[model samples]
Target: MNAPEPSAPGVRPEQEALFSTTAEHYARFRPGLPGPAVQLLAGTLAGRRAPVLLDLGTGTGQVPQALLAAVPRLAHVEAVDVNRAMLVQSRSVLGPLLGGRTLRLVHGSAHSYTAASGTDSVAPDLVTCCRSFHWMDRPAVLAMADRVAAPDATVAIMGDGSLWTHRAGWTRQLRELIQRHLGTARRAGPADAYTAPVRSYEEDLAASPWSDVAEHRCPVPRTWTPQGVVGYLRTTSFANAGLFPDSRHHDVFERDALTLLTALAEEDGPLVEQAEFRVLLARRPGGAR
Candidate 1:
């Protein structure tokens, strides 16, 4: 596979330097796949015989843990991450469920890690990447997935963009208040503010070595208390806890997120929104295409 491109401008440095430092907080704050999303992913692949799984950039094992409930017959599961600290934390969270069979956690970069030298097996029956797909170089990663994945294997990627900012009117205003307080440029929409520059599912899958590709979209909803929202932001890449030598920026981000949540909290009901996620699936070619 070709070398992964340098992260787009400011994104690379912040993602690498920041997330590892705040690994624990990130693991706690990062959202897990809702039941429906997991079910949808499982439904597509359940027919496969004895599927071995590889979850790329499996920070804290959220994706894998969710998958356990949906696809219980998992023969083998391997998770790879760039940050060793994240893998360690994932081991703690994931060890119990995968007791008898050792949970495979590899410390490596997804952009370049060849499956042959890296994993005991050269190709897995299934390969998955969650939110971290945007962090790696897309072309190289897709090529790597194509190379390392088994013939007839299905590769999947899923992301829930604009997760926190899904509420329309109140969400829009709350995000505005936070940006103003943080003294950042005002964004067009709450989702726009945190959006990352990555290839669309259609574009990336079309360019890869897959024979047939399909897109599945699901609205995976989850409720967040006022406190949960604040806790969630603490684990974000934009918080830049590591980028800044001091913790002041983190404090600022937390405070602003709290202010927004507090203002929106209702008398009896919790703040909630319709969180939508997209799953892109591609099947590796069975023979020379």
Candidate 2:
């Protein structure tokens, strides 16, 4: 997911800064949307001869990487992100996936992305935001999509719970350790606190141009190594490097977390999570693809 653009108002500063320092870890450790989720996103562009994708908060190009492989008619992708480092990382990771197709990386928040987003001329067939919609100014972003999206375009708001939100014995213990270091309140940014959105994504879309919606859920089982678990935490809002008081605090937290995860992995066999990857397929009520 992409962060906040320093200029875009109405979004939290913490949202923009969540994955800033851990760009590399995010590019490496954050898992892509499963096969079923990608296929559902692809299905939206069913009849378009050459579909263009506008991936808002295109962190490390995960949405495009999955969709490009699943939808061959997808010829161009204009990926926007708030972090330059993430865009740099995205370029490298998405390079191999583009078989002579176009993948343009735009540095801006989803709330900030527009038709004149530098070289981005994306009147996209399908607009996607994977693991990223929560970080946006939802109404503003939908309005932007309304202006820029092609006729009959589909907007897919997709995400899954993070390791911090997962339910499991190891996850419970891991949360406790994180709380011990960062406090009980989940940290969303440096010096900034976390809070729930005033409206759900569904409610936000209901009041926007994309009023009609359908949701799809894919249950995915995942296993993680102790090291993999640590890396994923390094990219999360509650436990990234930014939340620590100092380098020593971050280091100690990592050490303690690894120790905890290793023991759990040994005794429980695997550090596992049953994640529900969800896609909210929204389109304007009267529009038909």
Candidate 3:
């Protein structure tokens, strides 16, 4: 099927399929949830009975899985993504966890999701746009989120590995060199600043002037073997297929990534992949400003 016209501008066309087509690997290799982030979300949303949770851009349902595990009592979770492949992976992952009818998955873009139409008319108590937030038309997503969320509902935007800690000596510098040679479009080298912090969730929430808004940060330490590292990068929004049509570049990137990993291992290096996720939980303002 052809790509749908984006709900508006600013949405990347391939972002939808990039992770989806590689759904199995993504689900298999993507890092599992960090304890702090999940605990923070669970604590913030304590004591809600079967509240509806909307998982936006829920590729392979990792974030949703975490949410479900954290809030198993939810009435239902509605997970929407533009990738059917991703939805398939999600079903495989979330099928058993859901209590028969407690889970709903949709193939659609986050910008187009509407709580007042079709199967989503029931507003959600929480809407989460994990890692995929940057791929969205920010303005359009925020507007739609505002419309669909229940009063006092929370919107959480989260991405892991936004910060790269220099726990592994020489890794950061090596990454820079590799990234410099590969360029952004070329997937054939280390991703320098690949996981650098970009947008600030606090700023976004503050700018929106959301009522009862708060920001929380969690340090999620992750470990990956060399092969796992490669697979993990392949699952990224940046590493989407077709971005590097050049076979040579793709070959070189794989080679260099492995070489770097080997050297790190020789040095008895454990890649201390320190990542931080920020959650901007905001309730819809009551009665205007």
Candidate 4:
């Protein structure tokens, strides 16, 4: 299937496929959800004997990799991604990790993901959308979750702020440098500028069937090397190579950004990102479990 056309509240029509071409960079350098956040997500499955997971926007299979590592007893996972390349990367990353457990990949939008069957045994005990909710039609996906999620299943919407949203002296400098190359508006894909979502994730949750909710915050301290920073940027929508007019333009930008980052790292010691993983745990009105 072709990639999902961007029409979600978090993603406008312009930011198509989001990270369609950066699968390798995403698998390698994308600082996935924090360990504490993954642990918290894992903790939600303790009530189930052999928990099954339905992870939306399972980019590069980070959430599953982290969850499976944390919970060895995870029975099965249904990972969905609109970008087939991401799913391909997911297969490689998760293949070695799954010790004979089941992993089914759905190549479509999250809202379009349905279980292979309607049996309770196949319904997911835990449903997670991490770091990718902004790229989805929130209401539609949650509605779909209501249909497929187990009666007592927990629906978690989670993510953290990125370096583009970070406010630090050096990060601001880096953002400025990126703007110089890509322009003032934060580039979404090769064609469009990004717009902040009109509604908050909490608002979307409150309006959906999964209205009963709890918010969790995990403070994560991260240190990045100059090269690590560059690799990570390669995966970002704001500064990816596609946003540049040409490969040569991108190369120059990366070169200049690295020089600035190296200098900043040396002067400031360690380049740190004080990121917080936030999750909205939503359930039915009377609660599932």
Candidate 5:
């Protein structure tokens, strides 16, 4: 049977399939949350004895992995994602750290996932969606967070823009090369094309129940080699290897992309990708600003 089509605009059905097959590449090449970002998350739960966290769309469990490494007192984490393949990769990545603490891998989307209801159940002190909120129904997810979160809980929507959107000299040249090989239009899945987001994340958050929002910007410096850029591109929706019609097509694109990146890097030491990591914190009304 075929997969169901994505109902929402700006969501491509191919995303689910692409991520499922590229989980290994994602886990290997995707960057983790910066130290300051993790520290900010930890600071929010400073007074709690044993903080519990809910990571929505927790791809390969990167957010949880970083949090567990930084915040030793965190007692439990519920890593939720619709893709089971990503959860499998997450299990492998988080294997060593699961000794004393609890790491529950729940296979579900952000909007539908419910916390355990009994008195023994812990309310999440922090709910984080990193680089995955754009794919979700923001209002619905915020409503779910309102229902499941502790009174003082924080909902952090974090992302650094993708490789396709980055604006650097080398990145611009690389994009043009991709367009020349593929086409002028952006590709999503196999035949689907990419569409720009209609609404800003801030606009969606302000309309939700958790409307007390604050923004944090962290400059994360990254140096990417030609091979590293190619690896990362494979993990993105616009440039996933699976999107190509044939192996030959994918090989051609990869060869050209690498050659272009290498030529650009020859002028400089390595390609310095432009990235400003952003975290938008939304809290319940009347909570800390």
Candidate 6:
């Protein structure tokens, strides 16, 4: 029953600002969890009836939204995020699903959020952190999960590589074009830069309370048109339209990116992005951390 704290230590001001402004684009273009991944998480709760889920860094409620659609036994979801705009976008998209089930949207970081103080607040059967786990303090969040998770809870960390990391031929060309217009270096939020992780999520989880981890990967093939590629770029942190130096520059970049995609698609068919979506499940040992 502790009060929620301020932002966690891992939160960067620039990253927060970047995500806060791109809610609409994010909700529109970012892909949801794959069906197999959702099934794998839900499978961990086979006997639990009406399971409750705690989704940390629930950007636009994508994980919960997809789970609710896939897992009918889910009764409630506590969606937590630091960005208000992203939560707003979540509410807008998840409106219909909120009818019969309980969906509580909390404004807080993953390491600090808890269900509202009351006897009714249930310990979650599944704790999920989707693509937003990279932005969190892994140890702190895992410790927090240890405190709040149910005896048989499973902590699911899921993500697919972003467009920036994809190695498709057209994607490489597109990245080069972006670098030409912006700079050779990757652009993150204003005044912020991207760095490769010193430690992997697997390493971080291995050191946490939930160390008995199992990984599941699925091949998620995505096809995109030129316009779809442009839309997806606007949602990414590095290539967000807002990150451009000026409106004119943003427009020019978009135009050029579209042109590149169009040419690639003309030579081939729809630009297909081959991505592997991975989910790492860490369960509490013997019904306890």
Per-prediction backbone clash count: 0, 1, 3, 0, 0, 0
| Per-residue lDDT of 193 in model 4 | 83
Error of 3 at 280 (Å): 2.1
lDDT of 3: 0.65
**Which lDDT tens digits does candidate 2 get at residues 37-79?**
9889889999888889999988888898888888887889888
What does candidate 3's lDDT look like per residue over 124-240, in tens digits? 777888777766666677778777777767777777542123345545644554455445342411222233336665555555635457677787676667777666656754443
Give Cα distance to truth, residue 37, candidate 2, Å: 0.4
What is candidate 6's CA lDDT for residue 76?
Answer: 88
- The most accurate candidate by lDDT is 2
Per-residue accuracy of model 6 over 155-274 as CA lDDT, tens digit each: 999899888889989889998998887777787676667766689988988888888888989999999889988998888778887678788999999999988899999997878889
Per residue, candidate 4 scores C-alpha lDDT tens digits across 117-205 of 54445889889998889877888999999998888889999888799998788889999999888889998888778878899988998
Task: Identify the superior model by lDDT, candidate 3 or candidate 5.
Answer: 5
Rank order by lDDT, top first? 2, 4, 6, 5, 1, 3
Q: Residues 92-167, candidate 1: write the lDDT tens digits.
A: 8777777444466766677665543443663577778988787677778788777777776777888886543466
Per-residue error for 24 in candidate 3, Å, reads 1.9
Return model 1's CA RMSD, one decimal.
5.6
Model 1 global lDDT (CA atoms, 0 to 1): 0.66
Q: Rate the local accuracy (lDDT) of all candidates.
A: 0.66, 0.84, 0.65, 0.83, 0.81, 0.82
Across residues 1-289, which tens digit of lDDT does each residue of candidate 5 receive?
Answer: 1121122233334545757556889877888888888888888888889999999988898898998888888999888877767888888888787668877777666788776445377989999999989777778889989999998899999999977789877888888887887788887666767776689988888889888888999999999989999999887777878777788999999999988888888976789976889998889888753
> Which 10 residues in a row give candidate 3 its minimum summed lDDT?
1-10
TM-score of each: 0.80, 0.92, 0.79, 0.91, 0.91, 0.92
How far is 240's C-alpha from truth in model 6 (Å)? 0.5
Q: Which stretches of candidate 6 lie over 4 Å from their true place?
A: 1-12
